[model samples]
Target: MNAPTTPSTALDKHTGEPLRPTDGQLALAEAVRNGETRETHGTQTVPASRYTDPAHFEAEKRALFDRLPQVLCPSALLPEPGMAVPHDQTGRPLLITRDKQGEAHVFLNVCQHRGTRLVEGEDVQCSSKLVCPYHAWTYQLDGRLLALPRADTFPGLDKAQYGLKELPSCEAGGLIWFSPQADADFSLAETLGEDFSAFAMEQSFLFRRRTHTVKGNWKLIMDAFLESYHVLRLHANTIGPFFKDGITAGDTVGPHMRSAVGRLEEVEGVDFTDMAALRRVITFAYQLLPATVIVPSPDYVNVMVLMPQAHDLTLVEDFMLIPEAPATDKARDHWERSWALLDGGVFGSEDFRAAELGQQGLESGAVDHITLGTLEGGIKRFDETVQEYLRAVN
Candidate 1:
């Protein structure tokens, strides 16, 4: 894939500068803006209006989903030729399939007959054409209208005018991404940049999955994942003791951010050969622009992408990625066991409950604002990026 073009004299969306400030200056600016007057003890809060305001949510939908590189589906799940996935959150159905010429094309999955949906399930295969289950309207795998049920009944019905609506899509980093709206001038590789794209695409799959509906705002869920500060307190009985309390975060081009939590030297009761070696089990979290977090563990990796359903509800999909091939069953089994513990125990139980409770708090208005400490730097950067996007669209 061709690399994305980076302008030599482009200004940053937030700072409007060709170069960012030094580390110390940046930290100081962050502290001041966040109302942190004290060196390490001050804090500032984001108003509750930012969370509960309907207009703000609408702005987010346009700036983030309509104009960002979002992970729509995982490549492993839709690896077959005629597979299709429907994204109801975006108010459009996604038709993914390989054409007769052996290329992948993604289109708006809607039938011309009364605008009904064309595909329903996952991993479906059709050799000749994709026939609509509703009214038997047929279309070729390449999105050409093949046969309508009653073609002779209509006099001037143009088959050429009623093809499936196509969208710009690309497959990279073992994931499929599509823009829901037109006027997207950037490619997936361009949005992800060359070095990061190479690193992610080079890695293979370990395990993959889709998460159930999570009750919270999409930004709320994303904010929860952006930082590891809550891990020590909320996950105290779970995976908290294994990680350090502090967080290190950095912002990248686009809406992406990378974060790392310090690893604990030793857990009280756990026995391991080398404490230094055990520190290799650090958590690496990468937020892929708008709504996806790629979390890499020592044994495996998991991706959490948020799909907004309403003002206060979202669907979070989780996918696990591993090396292309594993040498031994023991290594694979180890990966699975580790994944189960993290997914079922930590995220599904602890973090999810916290988000729900936080949603309740936001709704209650007991506290008008939510504070972001220095430890939650990634969350602050995410909010700033969202603001930048809204500014662009406006």
Candidate 2:
């Protein structure tokens, strides 16, 4: 491994700390430069039914999505106190709110009074109280029932008991995570929180976010980020030239996975002390178990949270987080161009389009299984992790 020719005193623009590669990152850089990749001993295949079977999809919802903790949104979505948003992508209407204390909560969107949805739409609503559209029931941002019209009409009505039903939730690593199951455990987030915090996610700025209803199984969308095998072919015009073909390294964090790709033509001779030089040579992608993909670029990070709506449908919430909000016209233009290239061109046009096309082909009953090459081993590993979750419930 090439050592830093000179230790740099420059601080990281985002975190204000002297930037250097970790031991693990150094190892990955060496592997990429040596033309080495993490591969399975033999070719692997996943059943087409895994992507198209209705029964299997429902099982996944019941065993995994319902029970496991999910990333509701980035903390930047609710950047300020007294902010609330409606989220219905999990096949259940949910309300996410941040109280005056800046604490986050996830509650069932249903009104406690008459079971009517208390909130509607995806836009953020900044208010101290949430008023039910029907009957005028009002609740605090923390899910406490505050007031209701015509209170005298109801006998022995306890306002305390009528608070909105809340689920297990916490804000960590600049993201809001919640479980749909009332009794779900959140122990898994401890490690993942540390990993995300390492990237200074909590301090980042939310530049832009948009939701898409894509025609593909949620896993199909996730599969695109786990491998670099298709980068040169599928994204040849957009991002291919910026990355080395078939040169990648990865490791698993329990069910989660981390992958790294090198951008430089030769990483062996590059200086590691200079953060700028090191960043130009390597990029990291993190797969938060289930369906969240976090890819940090040189200047910004992209987070995609996938919600499985059905066997062939997925709700994708895409977020682009930057170091800070743009303050000048030049800075805004730079961030805008980066967003357009990545969010609009690379992911929307190339990666997601490929997933939709793959779904269409699989739907036609052409192949029993989708074969994976050595370079695409991350997909096979992901499938295995998912199967472990399904098996636990059975």
Worst 10 residues of 2 by lDDT: 1-10
Give each model a TM-score: 0.76, 0.90
Worst 10 residues of 1 by lDDT: 270-279
List all candidate RMSDs to the true structure.
9.9, 3.9
Residue 282 in model 2: lDDT = 74
- Taking the tens digit of each residue's C-alpha lDDT, what string does model 2 give over 43-103? 8899999999999999998888888888888898988999999998888899999999999
Name the best candidate (by TM-score): 2
* Deviation of model 2 at 369, angstroms: 1.1
Compared with the true structure, what per-residue lDDT tens digits does model 1 show for residues 1-394? 0111123332333354442223332342343333333222356566776677777888888877877656775565555566545556565577777667645677877887778778776544556577888889899887889898778887899999888888877766556777766765556445453422322332345374757577777777778777767877888877776664433434454556654443233223322222212223324466777788776554345777778876677777777765454568976666667667767767777776677778888989888988888666666667777788888989
List the global CA lDDT of all models.
0.63, 0.82
